[model samples]
Target: MNAGRPELSGTFGAVSSTHWLSSAAAMSVLERGGNAFDAAAAAGFVLQVVEPHFNGLGGDVPIVSYSAATQSVQVVCGQGPMPQAATIERFRSLGLEHIPGSGLLPAVVPGAFGAWMRMLAEHGTLPLADVLDHAIGYAENGFPLLAGAADAIEVLAPLFETEWTESGRVYLPDGRPPKAGALFRTPALATTYKRLLREAATAGGGREAQIAAAERAFYQGFVAEAIDSFVSSTAVLDATGRHHKGLLTGQDMADWRATVESPSSLSYRGLTVHKPGPWSQSPVFLQQLALLEGFDLHGMGLDSAEYIHTVTECAKLAFADREAWYGDPDHSDVPLDVLLSPAYTAARRALVEDKAAEVLRPGSPEGRTPFIPEQSAVDWPVADGSWMSQLANGLPTVVKATAARNDTCTIVVADRFGNLVAAVPSGGWLKSSPVVPGLGLSLGTRGQTMTLQEGHANSVGPGRRPRTTLSPSLVTKDGKPFMAFGTPGGDRQDQWTLGFFLAAVDFGLGLQAATETLAFHTDHFSASFTPHESRPKVLAVERNCDPEVIEELRSRGHDVEPAAEYSLGKVCAVAVDEKAGLLRAAASPRGRQTYAACR
Candidate 1:
């Protein structure tokens, strides 16, 4: 089955991590005759106000942009380096316990600012302040409470019980979380936005000016002083004798920038696929895709026994590589040249055993590098819901806790100028960071992904970035723009993305249909070398997948579990058919206020 270039459906397109404000900001940009880059920036800014847990201004951002004129796609690593003061010795000497979330210690340089500024500076035609007016207005004046935001705040009120340690203000007013549709205001946040606008206007009035304004305001001016004061008061670094370089410095703020890296590629199923350099999880994803492609995925059929088995086994194989060596490549050596080789992918995929548990780690081309990061052990036991019935028990089971949290938001935009942009901002979990008052903006606390232990691949170190999972991709097939997409849920991000790509291309679903389907992923790689993987083989799926499918998987000895709907992954995407000029978009329905639109 071949689909021709999609027809032009009147032209504007966008998708976001959540459904609520994504469409709002995208439409605003479209109405202004702005390009995809502008629309994406607008949407990302709007998201900072709409969904804080899933994203905020404090987190890091990475993007992949495509231009029809150039017929080329570029990737941006919107990750900030570890503070200069960060070191392995500091972590060990603390002797207090796990890296404390007390304040700036867990800080990573904020990248969303640099990404947005870069997009506007390089591709956007409109003024940065003009593009941000809508979001700034919304933040200052406040927007209606999204049912998702309200409900999430209610559930996580304990985190806001006290003022953010960095900024002495309560996250929730009067210790009460609001309900959906409530008028929530952030006067301090509004003030910050106004100051940024003022500085941008008074300065040279270019991308550099806008970025300078943000850095000075957030990292060195008012925001920096607040954070530095709080950290000093807390004595967080007393044991370590230093603080992260950019934590409260004019230099780090002035130097804040998103790195534009050279493109990297991997072969999957005879397709030459490229991903951003090591800043994101694109490497791990390429590994999984290559391993799965060797199995004839389209032939396995949707949710068929072979399909599930093949994908799961491939995940196990690929994840081994991920857990062992995947992290920010700038500070650590990743066997990328070896790992993505055709021979390596082929060997990893060949480990699938038909009609057998395949319970042992595959032996071949295994990583000899000795920097495997160790975590807690996993216990995978086989018990029966039906005393060895044909189907796995399918009972509700708690997914194991990883240091993971789903706090990223994404936006995809396409403009009439033939410019496409996909932006992913991670680290809205708000650990050790504070929200800018008037801006209603929160910075990223991304440094949390680092291990407190030394010599580990992800160990904390100055100028070294943490292993990031946010991968905003812009890809084409046979010389035409086809897809722009990303998701929340760290570690499993690319795994979830693989499902989305398969549904759209192999299953012939539209943007919405592809997004509505069931999804699943594995923690097998994150938990390496476990004696047994009692972890469920059948990932969380929609009830519609047919009970018989579960029965068959259980019959085959998979630990099947019924997961809360959409609990497995959060995904969003936007794609266009260049020949037809038709635009399409979708957001994860399983997520709160996750909405999308095309105009």
Candidate 2:
């Protein structure tokens, strides 16, 4: 396959992102002598502005980065916990079997701002104002509106006018959705950033103190106060088909702070792949790698029926385990050690037969019984508008005929000093929840990913982080930074990125070629989003896939569904050539918005 765009390479730095403006902003930071962390922080803020339909300041992000100065890879956990008042009993009392997908009830403590600030203060060379300047400018002045954002506004216009008035004020200026490619501005969002910057400047000391002050302002100061007042006082309509006030308060925001922790890692084909803990669905990628390692992926050939079946089966098994065992380790007893052990993979690998399996089978790790939450078919009122599109469609920005919402984005950057960062910024879409009054962002509906069932690893609880779908990937060759890569596909994130990795490592394809390779995923397990739907024995392959391969998969008991060409994944990646002293980057051409820059 010919990659529409070339794989970018340079010795100075390289940046890849789902949007051109974000990639350009990060690259500009690199040109200004900022490190990978600095560039990534700049890009994160810019993504919140430019891709409002995909992510926002009130969302969450999980970052995986390798710092040259520390010579270690670490995870910045930006996913916030449920409010102190949130509880499974509380939800059950509301006659809800599952967390509502949208509205204030599912809102968690907004975590993106704190996580970005933490990264900048700890690992970046630039100050808070410099890092946030690009986003502030884009939001204050005008930028071309994206077709997806316009579509989102159009879908939610009725709701905005009737219920989410705060959103109405921002997206439906003049009482209508903006046209695609028209100049659109979010002055309120720009004002929010400006206020934060002004507060940061009031701190007594240098760069670090200012960054700390900004973080405090967001979590403990005006931002928190506004969110508290809005959530506590407003009786808003949600997916439950009823009006309710949220449980989150100003204290919830104050109690939570983004934390830095060691990433879980596993070795595969001479590369050490690192991902966040079980709280995220990331380890499923490594688990798939472990199962696939037992097969001769090279012999099957890329995009072959044999290749697709094997990989799809492996993904089903891994994701089944994600539903059974993955959660916040701080809140539950997750046997991650046993789940990723070679013995576990060896046992689970046997479940992958020549044909597709129709049942959701999760293995018992350490002889402990697996608990699968009862799947419910909740007709979540995700109006036929932006909310439905964001949760039901496969990707955040693109229209796809899939059931899962991949409502997030990827950011990868590598600097000349061997520092690398990969982060997935997600949640708080313009349609997910009502925009907080006085703030230009919506609260994250991440709590919707948590189940209401008890005894499940990912059951909702006070102060517990939901088992999230957001995942960022980092890889090291010989214990040194090698590649940072990921995508924005709710449940399909690991599946899409896994295919790219196999194409690159097993088939010897370049970054761009590997990214543009045919994409596919199985809806064989429960989705992380609301309604928790699943389709056993189904495989969705891109239309670009060979017809013979599609038939071959169907013959093997797979209910194959064909998707639009270049619609499955929006992957972005950055790599370092240690021996050659070069940095490489690639962005998928799937959505026509993703871009890569290096020089």
Candidate 3:
């Protein structure tokens, strides 16, 4: 409950969404002669097995790594692409009008595996098999489930029980969700892993191995068949289906490929920041930083009426630009030039009413909206006109929910070597598909991020990845590694990341102090793609915030709900202290436990 703490001291370390992964991978990397990148990859691989309800091979990873040797930083965008066959007309033919909460539609060519492969090829010194050894062993043997994971399993079981092609395998041992702490494994995933190694060996080059294996195993091999059949089943192909009009075909899958993009960035408060273009608000958050420099943050004080009011006011101003000018820059001319210009920043700052909350301004800015067209995908084949929720492990929730990757996980590895790897591979659809035995992995129903709306900026289209809010971030000072961090709560990721990064750099707070300081988020669930997509009616707060602070926020024109745990993007991080030659790290304290290792 304390606001400030002295933690994250060490020479090397790692963290995950689940505790088992947090400890196991850190230990494995330390055992090897490898450094942070190797350990992070190992941890990522292990998470797919042990924490499969969210994130597996079937997800995307946008990563940032810092290299001390070169004193340079690099960011890779691995978010996947849409199916080639996707189209707005496709949805009409399927009698569908909106994206489903089950995350069963708008599935793309998963890119996380490819991202990992690329990271290893360019930066990792250890062998791929070696990097993944810990994960494979956990899948083949067994790993204990953490408390939160067990609860997630119970919470999403009902939704996954009878849906999807692989339903029987995940839900039925004799047909039931496994109890908490039960050992789980997945042989299918194990085979997939081995297949990758064999492909890696015979592949023309190291780079080709990861791609070849992923394409062969998931797209062209058994996984593809299972997926194709699942997509073509009576449900998705039905005239009345709620998801896409038809299941996926080999051709659609074949059209899928991971794309590499140039990083778009800007200067804010003397720091350089980068984010993907088209559907990312990194530029907007950056502009907010530039404008906030003019404000007297210390005068307003932390979490005071003026502070929250000012931040919220600035967020509204940024959102105004976001709603109108932020979209896929390739498809539309997002007014980024004008939006990020100094003129706009100064003008917006001048409009802020210091003493009174401006409750009337909407997120949309003046002039033409720059967002590109959004089309609906086909998720047809319905026998029943009605829809229902399938619980996973009978874990009760405080919110109404469809499903996303609630079992979200993160990994940060820093070694004696200069390279660093911090990744968050996440997205889980349900609980019914229990963690399989021997595979240590779960399938991702990542279709949830797509828009069902006919012409929204974030739509399901052929050859396009959905616009995602999950971003892995890196920070550097004077061209050297300083920190790598991120969180998993959908839209809340940016808000949390923005808060902590500012606190750490601007105010020079320690890791725990920066992370634990009062934080606020602007977007409500009402602003999301769907309402009731999460547990209902809660303000998702750190349990330790002073009760009066909660009351004061409630007094304002905002809803203040208290959470006893981390809700929006559970953050995990590692920062390199060059002077000390150490890697300081910590995981979200909202969980039962998370371990950090140092040499």
- Which residue pairs in candidate 2 collide? 406-490
Model 3 segments beyond 4 Å from truth? 1-6, 12-20, 68-71, 155-165, 202-216, 219-222, 233-247, 279-284, 354-367, 370-387, 390-407, 428-447, 452-456, 525-543, 551-555, 565-569
Q: Compared with the true structure, what per-residue lDDT tens digits does model 2 show for residues 1-599?
A: 23478888999999999999999999999888789999999999999998899999999999999999999999999999999999988998988887777788989999888888888888999877889889999999988998888987887687789888999999998998899999999998999999999998987689999999989999999999999999999998776667889999999999999999999999999999999999999999989999999999999998999999999999999999998899999989999889889898899999889989989889999899999889767755555555544443223343446533445889999999989999999988887888887789988888988888889878889999988899999999988999999998899999999999999998999888889999899989987876677889989998989999888899999999888788888899989887777889999888788899998
lDDT, residue 361, candidate 2: 89
Candidate number that wins on TM-score, 2 or 3: 2
| Candidate 1 wrong stretches, greater than 4 Å | 1-8, 12-17, 100-103, 155-170, 205-222, 235-251, 267-272, 355-367, 376-407, 430-443, 527-538
lDDT of 3 by residue, 299-377 (tens): 7666565566666667666654554445455544566666766776787788776433433242323354444223233
lDDT of 1 by residue, 486-575 (tens): 776666677777787777766777776676666766555442111212353434444546688777766766666666555555567777
RMSD of 3: 4.9
**TM-score of each model, in listed order:** 0.84, 0.97, 0.83
Off by over 4 Å in 2: 1-3, 379-406
**Which run of 10 residues does model 3 get worst, by summed lDDT?**
389-398
TM-score of candidate 2 versus the correct structure, residues matched by position = 0.97
Q: Cα lDDT for residue 96, model 3?
A: 54
Pitting candidate 1 against candidate 2, the one with the higher lDDT is 2
